[model samples]
Target chain A: MTEIKFWRGFFSILLVISLLFFIFHVWAVILPFAFGIIIAYLVNPLVDNLAAMGLKRSRVVLILYLILLGAGIMLAMTLIPSLIKEANAAVKELPAYTTAIDDLITKANGEIQKFIKPIFKSKSDVIAIPFAAQKFIDSLIPQLPQKILGVAHAGLWIIIIPFVSFFALSHGKSWIDIIFDSTPSEYVENLLGFMAELNATLGGYVRGLIIESLCVGLLTIAGLWAMGIKGAVLLGVITGLVNFVPFMAPLLGGGLALLTAYFQFKSFSVLVGIALLFIGVRLFDDFVLIPFVVGSSVHLHPVIMVFAILAGVEVAGFIGLVFAIPVAVVIKVFLSVALRHRKERLMFRHEHVYS
Target chain B: MNLSFYRLIKKLFNDENHGEEMSFLRGVPIFFGLSSHQLGRIMQAIQKRKYYAGEILFQEGQIGKAVFIIKTGRVELVKNVPEGGEPRLLGNLGPGQIFGEMALLEHRPRTASARVVEDGEIFLLYTATLEALLKNHPAIGVKLMRNIAVMLSALLRRTNQELENQKKS
Candidate 1:
């Protein structure tokens, strides 16, 4: 029996490691399906609501698809053209922006050198920040075409995601039923409890994140357009996408907005205004959007959250970062449930002995 | 109507015996007085599973997490005797009967064990799912809780009456 237990433990560990390894290796291939699953999960509550009203699940899914198709077509006709035009304009002005960036870096480097001159014995000892910045910009310009081409390659995802999500939305319940049916009767209750807890934790968070990002994106676009900033649409979209990563929204979004404002308008006041706008958005997000939308769905400690994000980055780069919080939430819920089950079992044993 | 139109209409509205399921749920004691729509919502949270004869649904003294409603099954409630002989048979339950319902009120040890007497299907409503529903839809929750309270009160009164009779004898 001891040998059997030892082999079981060993195999479990081995299985987990193998699964992780497989995921790491094939993540790029799996990304589109992962996105489909997330979309299905996000849309499930609406489907459930309508289904509870006695609508056929398949018909409801078909109706939802029709609505989404119409919306997508509308967006394609209107938003896509404007976005493309803005992107083309930005690419054309890249050289001018590079020059402006170089000039700014040079000026900043001069001031830094002046400040550090007394500390350093020789001028050569001082770092050339402007040179490094220029080199980095030069390196990035050559990669632009390739990066754009890579994005174009991902057009296949447009077809695959909805196809996968449609089936998932319609059939997700049956899949869950199959799992429940396969589980031993003794553990079925525990499985259900675990699922309930997981849904309670992650469902609200995922849905809230999407809504929050959309609001932020729309707000950013409106604010930038009001200020007559160039590339407002593109920048807003970028800002919204970056908002998924904690603490990145303001840093990357604000920095890009400031640069574009300064280079285009060449005014300190515009840069300051852009900075103030981001701060306002961040405040609004923290106070209103998060509180009302996300509520307290995830209860991970801030420290643990940071560590999970870092580990995610180390494991799978950007995808890892995007999924880190949800993964951490799952782990936390699993541990809590498992520990509770163990505690209950021990307590039951104690009671039985006394009885 | 043309055959294609008839088929389309049928496809659109046919939610496979949903009426039958709702009617069955309406017969449940805890769900008494709930509207058809309310019962439908509750049915969305219920999970149906099949159990074979001789299978244990739950054990005595184990923590309860879900209430089981027999859809088409015979279940027996059994309790362990203090003297450690054969377990005492509490009662047999059939379709529409529910067990482990106290778990919904609180996470506590089940008072008796439930075992499947015949192979059939049962519906499981997890406490967490019910709590979520209660939080989200209070009207349904109010009716369900009130019915549960009434049932418990009747049980208490019956027990009290039995105790009085035994004392008199």
Candidate 2:
């Protein structure tokens, strides 16, 4: 029995390691399936509502799938082309943007030299500072096109996501049922309960994140457009996408917008306006958007949140950072449930002894 | 494989069990008020499990999150005593009988452990699933909650009478 138990423990640990390895290696290949799961979970309440209204579950799934499919097609037809056009335009205008930035740097350097000329004896020393700065800035410019192309490649995954989601919505329950059926009866109830809790945690967080990102992106576009900033739509998309990363993402997004504004207008007033606009958005995010969409559901300590995000980044880079909070919430749920269950057991034992 | 092969595989795995599940769900009283269509919707969410005789389903003090209804065979609800005493049998439940009913509404610790007396098949309905159902269709939610309330009250009344008898004696 001891030998058998030892083997069981060893195998289970091995299984867990293998599973993690598999997930890490095939993360991109699993995107459709992951997105499918999210789609099914997000749409489940709506399906249940319709089912309660006397609609057949399968029929409702089919109808929802059709509606989503239609929307996706419509988006692809209209939005994709415009987005592509914008991307192309942005690419073609890259040199002009760099030239503008170079002009601003030279102009700023002259102003700096004039202010400091009285202190500096040699004119060459005054020219040296700006020349080194310009060289460093120029090095970064060549990498911009590669980064843009990388984003364009990532956009291709969106096409496969919805197709898989439709099938998932229609038949995800059966897949769950099949899993439950195969599991041991002793663990079945606990597993189901855990899955339900996990669903509640992740469903709310994922859906909320998507909505928050969309709101932030749209608000950013509107803000930037009002301030007459170039690349408002592109910057808005970047802001929305990066909003998934807590604390650091907004800072980076705002910095980019400010830099773009300064380059285009070459004025301190424009940069200040951009910064104030972001501050306003941040205030709205903290006060209004987050509370309404995400809620105060995951009460994780700030210290833990920071560590988890850093650990996530170490493991999986940007994707890891995006999933860090949700994963932490899952871990918190499991730990609390286990601790509570243990406490109940101890209390029962204590009472039994007294009785 | 061809379409027929895929169909055969699917039929063997998924479709064959739904008829059995649907029929069993139709017989449960908590689900009586719901139409066949509504019952069918509920049936999709039902998780079925089979246990051998002497298998433990759940332990006392376990946090209950779902109600279980027996499909076949017997289950005994047992409450443990302190050290040096045998477990006290609370009740023996048979086909169509439900246990852990309060779990559908509240997150409470189980008062008794459930163990199979005979090999059994059971259906579990989770509270989260019910909550979703309630949010979507309040009427159905109300009907189910009312049935649970009625059942609890009857159990309470019986327990009160038993306590009175024990006190008098």
Among the candidates, what TM-score does chain A have in each? 0.91, 0.78
lDDT of 2 by residue, B47-152 (tens): 7777789888888767788999999999999888767489888899999988988888767677788999998788888887667556556887877888787888
**Which regions of candidate 2 fall more than 4 Å away from where they truly are?**
A1-6, A54-56, A106-160, A226-228, A247-250, A262-273, A300-321, A331-355, B1-46, B50-54, B71-73, B80-88, B104-109, B117-121, B127-149, B164-169
Compute the interface RMSD for each candidate structure. Answer: 2.4, 5.6
In terms of lDDT, the poorest run of 10 residues in model 2 chain B is B9-18
TM-score each candidate: 0.93, 0.77
Model 1, A191-303: lDDT tens per residue?
89768866766677778888998889889999999999999999998888878777778888888888889878989988888988999999999999999987755678989
> What stretches of model 1 exceed 4 Å from their correct place?
A128-133, A141-149, A352-355, B1-11
Best by DockQ: 1
Q: Local error of candidate 1 at A355, Å?
A: 11
lDDT of 1 at A283: 97
Report per-candidate DockQ: 0.55, 0.22
Model 1 CAPRI rating: medium
